[model samples]
Target: MKLTASAKLVYNFTGPTEVIGLIQASHSGDQTILSEELILSPDAALVEDEDVRGDRRFRTCLSTETSIVYTATVDNGMRSLLPRSGRQHLWNELPPEALAYLLPSRFCPSDSFQRFAQREFGSAGDGVSRVMSILEWIAAEVDYVAGVSTPESSAAHTFTVRAGVCRDFTHLGITFCRALSIPARAVSAYSLDVQPPDFHAVMEVYLENAWWLVDPTRLAPIEGIIRIAHGRDAADTAFLTTDKACTVVSQTVQVSRVDTAS
Candidate 1:
């Protein structure tokens, strides 16, 4: 499928602010970019870099009393097959590099949820089955309410509240999967045709030596996801971060399918 995605971010800064933005479609085997551009108003010099985790970042400093607007648009081709249920890797079978996901992170405190996960999903037959069960459980239990969760919310908190947005759902899913010793991580992406269009969050689990995309929100087709970044949690994958005080003036995201190959 061919997709065009765009995001517009407007901010008002009080002083010189150093900012890092991660709002571009990732260049990877799963997706190929046809065209893309990012425009910054009151344009400042930007230093672009790709981090070790494959997140593309543009760093720039804004002048005092600045009103900044950043817009990005991209046309890309995405290839993602909805995965079938199958055998998954054992802890001992996973590569050493994949072990990091098992450890607790800020938003996904896997260690804290281990007992609950085992009690809740221990009867599941295999890793893939267990992960599916986790996703189903979250969907059945949580309310997808916006504003119910704050930026500081974590898997434990979301579990207690039984409600949150896409990121919270993704966090809880990752927490449960990791609690069961399945290596799962957070993924940020542009979701084609999601209602109330916004940047979306999902989770990827390593199974059979490969990562499979899963969405607890079930908002868009996994095939429609245009990945932007991957990390342990939202903190590492946030689209915008600034060192100085700034208030968001407006934000908008759009995504649409331009074409599809049958």
Candidate 2:
């Protein structure tokens, strides 16, 4: 499916501030890009780099207040297929690139949840079934409350509170998957047709030699999701990161589907 997406962030600076942002769509095997427009007011020198884990990063130093506007139009053909039963990847057969996701991370402490995961999902039929069970449990147990979780909130906190936004749900899912020895990572994306449209967060679990997308919030269709960044947790995939002091004056994100048959 084809979609158009944009994000605008207005910042007020008391002094010079350096910023690093990861808000551009990732050019992956499944998504085809048609066009993209990015602008920084009072333009400064911008540098782009890809991290070791394949996350794209953009950096700029701002001496004056500015607005960051990013717009993109792309076709997303990556749709979630029906979960395959009895499909699982053993530890010895897994690829080296997927090893990091199986370990604990900043927001997702998979090591601490081993007992809980095994007790709750150990009897599941297969890896995919356990992941489905985890998704269902989170969807039913967690309350989707906005502004309740802070940037420092971790999977353990969300698990205890049993309430959080999409990011929390994703972290919990990733944590559970990793605790059970399944590789999982957090995914940032522009989700078309999601209510209260905004930049959305979901997750992907590696199973049967492929990463499969899963939305714990179940708020958006899998086909309408366009990935921007992939990371172990929210810390690595944040839309904006800064080394200097700055206050957010205003922020807005918009996403919509465009009909081509007009």
Candidate 3:
């Protein structure tokens, strides 16, 4: 299977922003079932991107303008990849000293999440299964609703509200994985082939010494996917940035997966 997607971002700011940054998390990577063949992030002065090993990585671009425009595209090759042992070779660099500090306060580094790990997956179990189980549980238990929250939304909110979009879902997944010492991070990217290029979010966990991506916000639980940008959290990766003094007039996005039959 091959997957591709595109996103056009438009920004509006009243006055020049002292500084503005945009995160285009619109690239998918090679997976057990998918391989990224090509990824193109628009270099239109306002968008600079980099290649990463995981599902979503950021191309941070800074601007001092009132408005900015940019686009991103990703091509993925689908393959059926799965978990294997001895994969955590790269993660050997992960320091225990950094584990506790990796997650911030909003991530809910609480005993509730920690204890849940003990009761459900046990703290010592494999990281992939632990993260996967948490994602499945979140997707099944939480209902979906639009305009309910933003990327700054908390994991505790998702568990309580039982409804939110991709940002909320990924937040819950990230917090849970990190709380359990799995070294999960939040990914903010675009979902192409989606009716209005919607912001897609996911959580990538450190396992087998490397990062394995998971999309808790999979609009559809099927395969054939494209990914974009990723970061520690939404704060580190947002598709749009407004100037300090500008007012947004309107915004829209259109994303679609190519239907070869069409």
Candidate 2, residues 132-229, lDDT tens digits: the string is: 98988998899999888998999999999999999999999999999999999999999977777778999999987788888899998888888899
Which of the predicted structures, 2 or 3, would earn the higher TM-score when compared with the native? 2
Worst lDDT 10-window in candidate 3: 31-40
TM-score of each: 0.93, 0.96, 0.70
Tens-place lDDT digits, model 3, residues 87-120: 2222346855335324655544433577765576
Pairs of colliding residues, candidate 2: none
Candidate 3 Cα deviation (angstroms), residue 73 = 4.2
Residue-wise lDDT of candidate 1 within 39-150, one digit each (tens)? 8877789899976656688889985444433333444344554355656677788888789888899999999989999999978877777887898899899999999999
Backbone clash tally (model 1): 0
Give candidate 2 regions above 4 Å deviation.
51-54
Which runs of model 1 end up more than 4 angstroms from their true locations? Answer: 64-78, 260-262
Local accuracy by lDDT, each model: 0.83, 0.88, 0.54
RMSD of 1: 2.2
